[model samples]
Target chain A: MNWRGNALKFCDVAGLPALEPFVRLLAGEDVKEQLKGIAKFVVLPVAAVAVFLLLWSAAARTVVTDSMQLPSPTDTWTAGKELFAMHSAQRAEDLKVKQEKTMQAVTLLAQANSVTKQAESATGERKETLLANALVLKKKAVQAANYRPSSAPTFVDQIITSLKTVFVGFAIATLIAVPIGVLCGMSPWCNAALTPFIQIFKPVSPLAWLPLAFLIIVWAYSGTKPGENFFDKAFLISAITVSLCSLWPTLVNTTLGVASVDKDYMNVARVLKLSWSQQLFKIILPASLPLMFAGLRISLGVGWMVLIAADMLAQNPGLGKFVWDEFQNGSSQTYARIAFSVIIIGLIGLLLDRIMIFMRNLVSFGDPQAA
Target chain B: MSVAVLDRPRSKAIARPAPPDPLISMRAVCKGYGSGVTRNEVLSNINLNLRKGEFLAIVGFSGSGKTTLTKLLAGLEIPDSGEIVMDNEIIKGPSQERGIVFQNYSLLPWLTVRGNIALSVDRVFKHWSRGERRDHVEKFIEMVGLSHAVHRRPHELSGGMRQRVSLARTLAMKPNVLLLDEPLSALDALTRSVLQEEILKIWEEERQTCLLITNDVDEAILLADRIVPLNPGPNASLGPAFSVELERPRDKTALNHNETFKGLRNAVTNYLVAVRQKSRDDEALASEAPPIELPELQPRSLRVPRGRAG
Candidate 1:
């Protein structure tokens, strides 16, 4: 028996069949063949990427904007480094201020506690005075304890904020889409009821929904004082816009998936006298998961794309806003920074897609087994 | 035929007088598809009584509603105008009491060989402990000679192996009625015969009230005690039931030389041919009457492999 067979099988199932040659090479199958495989898979892709960079740099020289020239690969790299440095510096400054305030609060709290202990053993007037002094110190400590960094959000901060926003939007979309999708899939009446709306709204872009989302969110949070709630009105507006635009793919995919669950499986479930919920969870859900996850992957991609536009329009503190700010900043580094963000966004999208594929394969029966 | 025949080896039990009551009773069952002008009637007035521990086969040509009949009996489909009673209880919906093995080997693809069987076993024997359930599932898997494939998914298995998994899944449920919906029809001849023998062996051991649906006369003769021929459709009905006087542990190879087997096979085949000719004649006459352009209906004959049965 081949000892490397199990490792090869894992590579096959993990959608990394290209790695099988590497495994075989490591197992000492054939050096020449393994080198060829490595050249084809690994070396070729890297060479292609290098060629692409060369083309990009060449193109960058030819294309010139009104205020600035198109940033080259080197310029983008430099801008990226500067952004990282700025984030690090801001982070350090914030940390130092926060630490100082926390220290002050701790000292004040200690003073207040000592005063209260002394007041416990004192006479009436003196004790009352001491208690009053402790109360003032406690108030001061509370004030000092609320040490929020007042610095402008950095590039890294924008990325985190954008990720958080997209996640919130995607989660909301899932919550709204799945049950409705299931209902539509399972029942003709539900499908008929919802299809018209889905068709009409599915094509609407995030930009179109922005103003409406803003109005509704602003109205909803009209009474909410700023900094009181975690979700600021603008953040809600941007995220809701992302959800509205991104939800369609998941909804449509889920519906298709659920609707296409095998009749044979349904018969099996029925004959087994499985409960309705059991049928849904065990048979229906598992069968439909592959398509549902495919939808989710598409939805996430759409959500990420839509979030930038939403942030730019709504002026929410995310990568989109950062891009808009840089565009308005009109510095020599602005084009470079924008180019770097574009690459970053693309990489993030690719990563998300890979993650989704992994999730989908985990639950799928097989990768569409032919016969 | 009498109660004494039940006790005797290789006795014709189908000729026995209606004993006490059957395990299931289908009364004037009718089923159709579509509506109004487009509506096509499949089974008409299907009245069947399946006795306890009886091996019955329903033989029909393709589209003669044999599958529909099985589906009705399995409680997967409700009849248009009749009732199916099982153990004096009216059949309302599918239940764990009636287990079916479908032609397509309807093993859940996501599940391993053991998992497919375990799904049914767990459902039926909810009271059984986890260890007991696993043991029961493993027992059936081994019985089907699929112990090596216990961890393999359906797609990884061959057609024959997949069918075996489906069989194991149904049998592991230990249902009161075992329904085989042309289960071995999808398999190759060699695998078909092997599985047929395995099925015969399992039926002998379990003695579950079995219903085997097939298009093969030899298959019906090989396994079933009573063979019911379903007439060709538009509105198909049962032709008549023939009893096979075959013994338990019957050998297919030996049966090839047996006069009784020859007679039985010929009788069933002739009956099927007659029905086919009649249906063809009816179709010819109906089309001839209509001058208006109508698409000619292709007659589908029973796809019997020439050398295998004969």
Candidate 2:
């Protein structure tokens, strides 16, 4: 049948008087039912999460791995509780241990060229090393070592620290990336100048920056007069490394987003005699939102991943370091702690992604996807 | 409460005479592209004035620079070498005093119909309380007869509905001037007529100065008080303005019977034909000219590209 005839036929069926009233009555009731259905859809995920936990517990009883080192989920739960208690015992102690180890490693690597130099700097060194008078002097060695524990940071601490790093790095990246993207979108010269650089740097792996981060951080501390908090060096390094690594997605997405804003709206802005700033803020941002948010989401995810890698290498006092420490420690509880940490990491990543998506929906003006 | 409430646009509101100086005045405006060795003018020495509360339609052929002229009036682009003055100020950039509608509804896809309307209001009335923005947007949505679809997003709406939302958004801003860039061209005839009536009712009630860049002469006859014919370019300009002396609240059904309206439309048709001929002449004359030596005539196809449309 031709299109018009088909439309007429469909209308004939759909517009029946008896069906119309019935449909309307049903629809009114259906709306209530629909609300119920939506509530179920929302609740189902939570229920599914519970079911998965139950399954995991079941699997815990029946060992899933041959390695005695690897714990069942139940074992991980017990270990997790203990770790949490230990972390809560004294918050500063763990941080101090980690810091001292890193500092010891740095001090060993820096001034240990000769026994003469070591003796020369004996007064500056911590008292424990200088007290060992019976120690035999050997040829100068430049080796440095960090003491990584056999268990992860407690679940709560892991959650908190990982959350913080992701938040800090993601926030910094967002603050820097969005405006640069907007500038690139609005100005041809900026796009031209920046796109080449963005293309070049965006592909460089986050791991690639590890060497540079360590060098710069070490240099920065030594260059400063004295007595700077050692933790700041690690935090700053990881944050900057994550920020640089995570910057592209937000920037690229924002630029493309602003570029893709509808022409008619820009015309509307023009007709309103809006300032360039006003146009960017009022029109471009609102219009570019879906894409901009997409970029932000990706940037944050990348930041979270990069933070873990950076922490593991830099031995930053976060989930990243905790995970690495657990691996190196090789304790009987290591597997359980690692499992708990893995779950925490997944949850945190999910939570961070959700936060960005929420913001995206809020900013989005016309799209149903925003909902 | 009474004055503000009663200020709703309605029938029997007579249009007040425009202030002595035109609200927007365009004088000796010449715009060209491809400078130096490859220069060609798009609009040349074009002079016009937009009186307050006037519905002015500009009609022309495909390459006649109608959209260019509209963009200039709306402050979207600076002219190559001429000044466009709005009120007494030289147009520096976009402003809140004018609203524009495009042939393709430029409603942000991410926004709901109501949200799109709210965005324009939000920009202009940043100081307005949230409730005020809601109230103003609701009024325009009701005015455009889309109260049922306020929560519907742009992609969800049909083309006509999207255009209605776009109109609702624009009108909600209550600009002194409203520019329509062939807003009805993309719609089917039925939807076009429906929207035409809606837009006419809006103009009659609000009495804002409106400039419509259209190719439809009959539309010009029905809606515009003055219809200007754009002579096509390398160096196009408005030939003359024809005054539509038809009475207020002009009905579309009555348009065919109105001889004066017919005569005016005929004149516009004649002018447009002259424009088409002129463009052909120019294209033929410049056939061997450098390929780059031409004004980039704003692409006339309704679905223009994204971005600045720059």
Candidate 3:
């Protein structure tokens, strides 16, 4: 029962390159048809946006009083170009700052004279001048350390970082959620004792939790610090926050999935004298995959949003920070850039979801009639 | 030459009483659900024994608690009251010693035909190399004539093909006892008959202790060394056991003309008649037991339309 759809159809729908081999395969088999199914699923938001654009464009085609507030498609495109140019200039500024910082740090490290010696009035004014120069260089290095490229960060770069954070949080949540959920679902007592606590935490918003997380973590790790850099702290906070928010869906779904496993499979598990390992591997996991994936995908999306909000506040170096910085910049171009960023973020999120679905489909592909 | 195939096994059985003990023994068996407040006694005060290499058929109407009994034997559900001893020990849970083939063909929806079979084989024979499990499963798939669907998922498969995978999975396990809980009842007539023969052939080669639960009279008689009937559902008990006196290596094509085969068929048909009458009897008079007092089966007890002449 092969469930494979048309690859060509998927490609055509996705607007991917024809890629001769794929087209041929689709023609040769029903590969293109299956691919089309996948493409249709993924193109929903894109299609919606395209329709919105067409309508917006049709309206914008007229001057509509030629108001500056009414930024037309052409204006948006020009704005996009302007923002890109600004970012390019900003990126150059950032690189210069980084290069200067690196040179200062290297010079300081290689400096033959100690700061204390340089401060001594060995040559009167020359000594003062040397010490002042060192101090200024150190300050510049610190400032440069904070500087990042101003060029509009590519959507792909943001996606990578976004993916990293979401996956990290999701991974942490899965590690905690699946086992706990499976345990809770399998045992009523476990469910009773542990489940309510989860529900309590589940409903608590990431924004609400951020302050508490900040206070708790900074306080907890104030002493005996391990990697207390901004990036590390942001990663930790996002992961913990995500674990709190993302875990519930997976936990709830997994419990339901495990609880509702078909009795027939259970019977077969028994007859085979399946080891605990075997029972879980051959029956329980596969039976639960459909449901587990549902939870995972939900958790991932939630985590992605959570990371964005967390980053905006945390000033974590990612697209969320980009959005926050853009908003703070409060320039006309930055807002449009923000809008563009938002689109990119949504596209990345959509693609991330598709990847998980693709993995699941891989499992169900060979059996067209897989129950 | 054909007779020799059947002869080899019978001679071995006669020469060596084929191990002294019964393969599976039941003593004072009782199984039920709910408690004193809401108790439904499905099977009670039951005692039976199954010996090695015996093809035992359990016949009953739906809700006769035959499914429960099969489940108990398969180690799916624990016997609420009595003991089921396999290899001289009380069977508490499912073991590789027993393998169950479910009626609905419980193959994983995500797995291909080959993948489904290999999953069990791989899980049980964890030490076996991957290649070995693959080859082993593929051979059985070939045996069941499902080679074409080796990579197909469950939904892609026909009902008959899925059943074949179920058969293949259990056979690959090579358990000492094979439990069939109306395994072929869900299939079309043609598929059912063909699978029936496939099952018979597998049993012949493997010589495992087999217990089949079904409502079909012909199926029971055709596949069993002995047929055991359940009297009725919801407090139903085991009825008399009848030995199938048909000749060895029974030919399904030629068996209808044989007098002994006719006798066995007539006897199973009689049991079927009893089941139908019992169903009608249970139904015509509304169950005095309230819905709460009823087992799931008690509520939806199937009254299969058959001649109610006992």
Candidate 4:
């Protein structure tokens, strides 16, 4: 019974209420109701998706263009599989090349050792020539050992890059937004001061910020040569642009949350004689956390959306870049690949949203439906 | 002043000489909302004293600014005029010396029963070791008989239970004064009585200087050593103080049969009812104006008559 309750709670927190009926049924309570719940929550949604896919495939056959036709569901699936296969093949090829280089280096070193041994026994000119040959072999071995394979990023690699960029950008946004937001919420003076900037910049697009971010990052990295810089300039620009665009929701929400803490809670804080810092950490923060997390969820979502656009515009090595490149390629398979990428992007976005919801639920105190 | 003087309890006549100075005193305190013509006076020229270790209850009608009075006493609000003093120090703002149990049971919803109590206990006893703080919180939780629900959040608890947690939190603060702002008014009648007894029991044990703001007359009589009525508002003031001479461990069922309890209950109830009626009458007279006559009219149906049905 305890485990059943915990499982239901886990479902709620994970934003998977569809599984609740199964848990209840397993607990042996109201089988009929549970079945109805399962049908409504789980089976119905699956059926709807199936219907959607069928309609999409049927529509794909009728829609044609000079450049390419709309990709059918099967075409997109095949494209996705091919992309994954390409990624795996590239990885295997790279590994094989590295191994071949290592094997060559080993053979070269053995030759160098044999030459050095021969040189030790040789006389005069022959001895010098043998030593020189060993030196040449040793140099060749060194070159082979230092071999590095630099190739275009695979689909998986681009996906990883995109995830990394989004996370970093989201992190930067949270760090910057939360503190300033707290200040704005806690003090009317700060709020008044920041309101103009927030109002003006909040509606601005990530596209508008991209060039400016690129310029600033380029200037900052001017002293370091292109490949020598710690962070890739393109990556920084995209991330910074993402942070710039996504920070508003969190800032606004935090201010509202902090400013509108229940009057009763403030009274309690006063009565307790908690210090300003203590009041903030103990009373204000905890009280406002639900709203703050709500804001963060929005901010993260905005950041993810902005990051893809930034990546596309900035030509950063990410999923957005992959899509852009595929579009530019304009081959017979281009439409199918783009369709596959669209699904992947939507799925990733949904996953990110669910993760945010889970986090929001954790901080939402007793209000399970806060998000 | 005249009404208070006339309504003063006869118990004052038998007062002992050289009683200890009040632990807290409010002198000519006046508080109001708004300004100029629209100003609404919530409390006017209020004067009161709370002696150390005495349980005092202020009984008033809903919206008579009972909460405002409690807030003023708790130092959550400062009087617009006059002053509130504690031990010769002017009251300025809320402090740990004064703890309040809000009517809504203002328990931090995110925190469990132990965490709620521990928040106050930890702050008030900052010098105490972690174990000491934990034990102190546990003790207070035990005092309120909420040990079983120690890990439950306020939302998870019943209203009665939440109020109990609120009580424990305030008690754990070890405050010099406990201000209860109608803490049990929101509970059911059965829960109210049970809490009333629990409060009486705690008061007996702790003898802390406490002030309760409530509308329940019987509850005031049951818990308070002295009962003061806050007359209905837009300039509410304390009426006369009534002393309850009822014996300790006053049982709710048994108090019905006790002569002193019955007398005190009736007196407080009567006083509150009278003042409320008078205030209402005064408001009515002040706002009285000539009645406006309405034009006579009748609603006509949109449907055609039988003769014109074609």
Candidate 5:
């Protein structure tokens, strides 16, 4: 019984309420109600998706373009499979090439050792020639040992890049927004001063910020050569654009959350004679966490969306660039690959949202209704 | 008989001789909100003294600014005019010297019962070692009989349990003066009486100078050494103070049979009712004004006739 309750709690915490019906049913709750829940939460969504796929397949045959037809469900699945196969094959090939280079280096090192041994026992002119040969062999071995396969990133690698970029951008946005938001919340003067800038910049699109971000990053890194920089220029530019566009939600939410801490709680803090820092850390911040997380979720979602678009525009090596490059290629499989990518992007976005919700629930206190 | 004694003329001042030096004193305190014509005076020209180790209760109606008075004493709010002095120093801001149990059980919902109590103990006794502070918190939590619910958050606890945690939190601070603002008013009657008894037991043990703000006449008669009524507001002020002379280790059931308790309850209740009625009558008299006349008008039809339709 204890475990059953914990299971349900786990479901709630994980933002997976759909699993509750099954858990309840297993726990011997009302069967009829559980059945209804299963129908609503489990079966219906699956059925709806199936119906959608059927409709998509039917529609794909009807629409025809000069270049290619719209991708059917099967076509998209096939394209997704091909992409995954290609990624695995590329990884294997890279691994094989690295192994071959290592073997070549080993062989060259052995030859250099043999040549050095021969040079030690040789007479004057022959000894010099042998020593020279050994030196060349050693140099070649080092070059071979240091060999790397510089192949382009596959679809999976692009996805990983996109994920990394978005997370970095989200982290940057949160770092900048939360403290400023707290200042704005705590001090009316700070709020008033920042209001105009927030209003002006909030509505500016990521596309609009991209060029400005690019220019600033470029100017900042002007001294450093292209490959010598710590971060790639395009990656930094895209991430900055994402942060610029996405920071507003978190900023606004944190300000609201901090400002709207319950008056009663503040009175308690006062009665306790808590210092300003203590009050902020112990009372204000904890109390505002639910709303702050809600804001973070929105900011992350915005950041993810912005990152994709920024990637496409900036030609950053990510999912957005993959889609863009596919479009440019205009092969028979291009439409299908794009459709497959669309699904991946949507799923990733959904996962991000779910994670944020889970985090929000973790900090949410007092009222379940509030969470 | 105590009934005959109760029928005697009542006075506004405490019948008992005043203590030489009070722990806390409010002098001609006035607080209000708004400005000009819209200004609402909640407490005006209020003066009271909390003698050291005395249990004092201020009984009033809901809107009679009992909370404002509590906040003033707690130093959460400074009076608009006049001064509140504690230990011969003018009250500037809230300090750990005076701890308040709010009417709404202002236990931080995010904190567990232990955390709520420890928060105050940790802050107030900053010089104490971690173990000492923890023991102090545990002692108060046990005193309030909430040891079982130590790990429970405020929302997870019942209304009475939450109030108990609030009481434990304030008590854990070991303030020289304790202010309780209708802390049990939100609970059910059964829970209210239970908590009242627990509060009484704790008070008997600790004997801190305590101030209780409540609307319950019987509750005031039961727990407090003296009862002071706050008159109904716009400008609520203190009424007469009634001394509860009933012997302690007071039992609720025995108090029902006790004539002194009965008479004291009746006297306080009658006084509060009379003052409330008088205030209502004054408000009615002040609100009496000449009625204004309005112009009569008819609703005009906006429809066109059939002949005009062409």
Candidate 6:
């Protein structure tokens, strides 16, 4: 019975409450309720997805344009497979080319080394030429060692790129917002000072901020060559825009969480005579974490949504660019690939939210349902 | 039954001569909230002394600012006027010497029973080795009979269990002054009585100077050596103190027929009822007064301070 409770708790933390019914069924408790639980948690969701797919397929068949038709489920599936195949083939080709160049460079360097050893006895022009050739061979070998994939990013690569960009933006936003939020929550004076600025900036869209972000990035990178800079200008611009737009939810939520911490807890801290930092970390942070995570989940979702637009506007190399490029191409398969990307984006967003919920459950003391 | 008793007034009932040195002393302390026209006085001209190894319980009705007084004692909030001295030093803020078990059982929810107790033990006993600290924490957990729930979080525990964990945590700290703020009022009657016994046993063993704020008069008699009641007022102050002369290892069942128990219980009940009615009458008179009337002028040379609650 205890192990069954432990199993149910594990399921709850893992954001799979549906799994509890199976655990209860195995434990031989309340067969009727367990069966109902299984049906409600498992069977219903599958049925809903099936109905959604069927409707999507019917809707896809009805829509048509001069250049392309809307993609059905089968078309989207094929397009997804093709995208994976394209990525693998490109990776293979790049590897083969790099391997061939490396071998040729190694052979040339060996030849150059042997010639330089012979040139020890030789004088003037032959020795100089041998040394220069060796230098050139070593340079060639270094160049061959540097393997850069020249292929335009495949769907998988674009997905990874978008994830990376959004995370970078989310990380920057969290770092900036949490401290500010804590300051505001802890002090009425700070809250008063920051409230006006936050209110003014919060409603500004990523699209509205993109041009300003781009300008700032361009100015910062002006002294350096394009590839020599610390980060690509396009990527930085897109990320900054994402940071600007997605920061508000987390900031607002954290402030609310911190401000609303129980007075009894604060008194306990005082009675303990905990240091300022201890009170913040041990009492304030743990107490506020549930609401903070709620804010973070919202921020991540907003960041993900904003990243696509940022990528498209700045022509950053991510899924949004991929979609924009496909739209421009207007091929027979373009609509299907776009449909596949849309589903993939939605799935990724769902997964990110589930991961946040799992984390919230771990740190939270309140009911998991509240989160 | 007690308008005549109210006429006996405050300075005569329960005041005691001060011992030479006290663990805690509050002198003419006054506390209120807000400013100017909106200022609401909660406690006024309060004087109290807590001797070493004493168990004191403070009983008051809801909204009588019992919490405000406790907060002042804990040094969580400073009084508007007057000084609260502990060990001859005026307390400016909270210190480790004073630990509080709040009424709500303010256990950090994310922490398990062991973790909650360990948090305080580790902080206070920083000089102790890791094994010693863990051993100390386990000892308190056992004392509280929470050994089975050592790894359970607060949310998993019942109300009685949570309060027990809270008690364990405070006792584990080994604070010189253990301030309990209505810690048992939230529990069911059975659990409350069970805990009241547990508290008695623990206090007998440890003998830490404890101050408890509670609404239950029976609880006050059961656990405390001295019981203090707060009068109902906008400026509510300590009314009277009753010392329990009952023997140690007293039983709840046997106390029912005890003559001293009956006498003390009647006196406390009568005092509480009289003050509550008087405050209600004061409210009625104030409402009946004309709102537009000019404030009366007092003779500045002949003003006198109010008497302290005994």
True contacts kept of each: 0.79, 0.71, 0.82, 0.95, 0.89, 0.87
Ranking the candidates on TM-score from highest down gives: 5, 4, 6, 1, 3, 2
Q: What is the TM-score of chain A alone in each candidate?
A: 0.92, 0.67, 0.67, 0.91, 0.93, 0.95
CA shift of B217, model 5, Å: 0.9
Per-residue lDDT tens digits for candidate 3, residues A152-240, read: 55544455666677787789999999998888867789898987798788888899988877887677677756654544776677667
User: What is the i-RMS of every prediction?
Assistant: 1.2, 3.5, 2.7, 1.0, 1.1, 1.3
Chain B TM-scores of the candidates: 0.87, 0.83, 0.82, 0.89, 0.88, 0.87
Candidate 4 residues B69-91, lDDT tens each?
99999888899998999999999
Tell me the lDDT of candidate 6.
0.87
Q: Report DockQ per prediction, comma-separated.
A: 0.55, 0.33, 0.43, 0.69, 0.69, 0.56
- Candidate 5: C-alpha RMSD after superposition: 5.4
CA shift at A44, candidate 3, in angstroms? 11
TM-score of each: 0.87, 0.62, 0.75, 0.92, 0.93, 0.90
Writing each residue's lDDT as its tens digit, candidate 5 over A43-119 gives 99999999999899989999987767999999999999999999999999999999999999999999999999998
User: A1-371 in candidate 6: lDDT tens per residue?
Assistant: 88998898888886897898999999998999999999999999999999999998998888876766889999999999999999999989988988888787788778778877877988999889878887887787777767576888888889998998999999999999999999888888999999999999999999999999988988888878877976778889989999998899999999999999998888778777788999999999889998899899899999999998999999989999999999999888998999999999999998998888888788776578523
For model 3, what is the C-alpha lDDT against the true structure?
Answer: 0.74
Residue B12 error, candidate 2, Å: 32
lDDT of 2 by residue, A101-120 (tens): 66766555444434445555
- For B1-310, candidate 1 gives per-residue lDDT tens digits of 0001122333444465655468998888889999999999998887788899899998999988989999999999999997999988899889888989999987787888888898888888999899999899989999999998899998789999999999989988888999999998888999999999999998999888999999989999999988888888878888777888888789999999999999999988998889889988988898885567768888889888888886
Model 3: CAPRI class: acceptable
lDDT of candidate 1 at residue B229, scale 0 to 100: 87
Residue range A1-371, candidate 1, lDDT tens digits: 36687787666556665687899888988899899988988889899999999999999999996777989999999999999999999999999999999999999999999999999999989999999999999999999899799899999889988888999999999999988888888888899999999999999999999999988988888887998988977788889999999899999999999999999999999898789898998799888988898899889999999999999999989999999999999988999999999999888877877777667766776573111
Interface RMSD of 5: 1.1
User: Who is ahead in DockQ, 2 or 5?
Assistant: 5
- What root-mean-square deviation over C-alphas does model 6 reach? 9.4
Docking class of 4: medium
Docking class of 1: medium
Instruction: List lDDT for all candidates, in order.
Output: 0.88, 0.75, 0.74, 0.89, 0.89, 0.87
User: Model 1's DockQ?
Assistant: 0.55
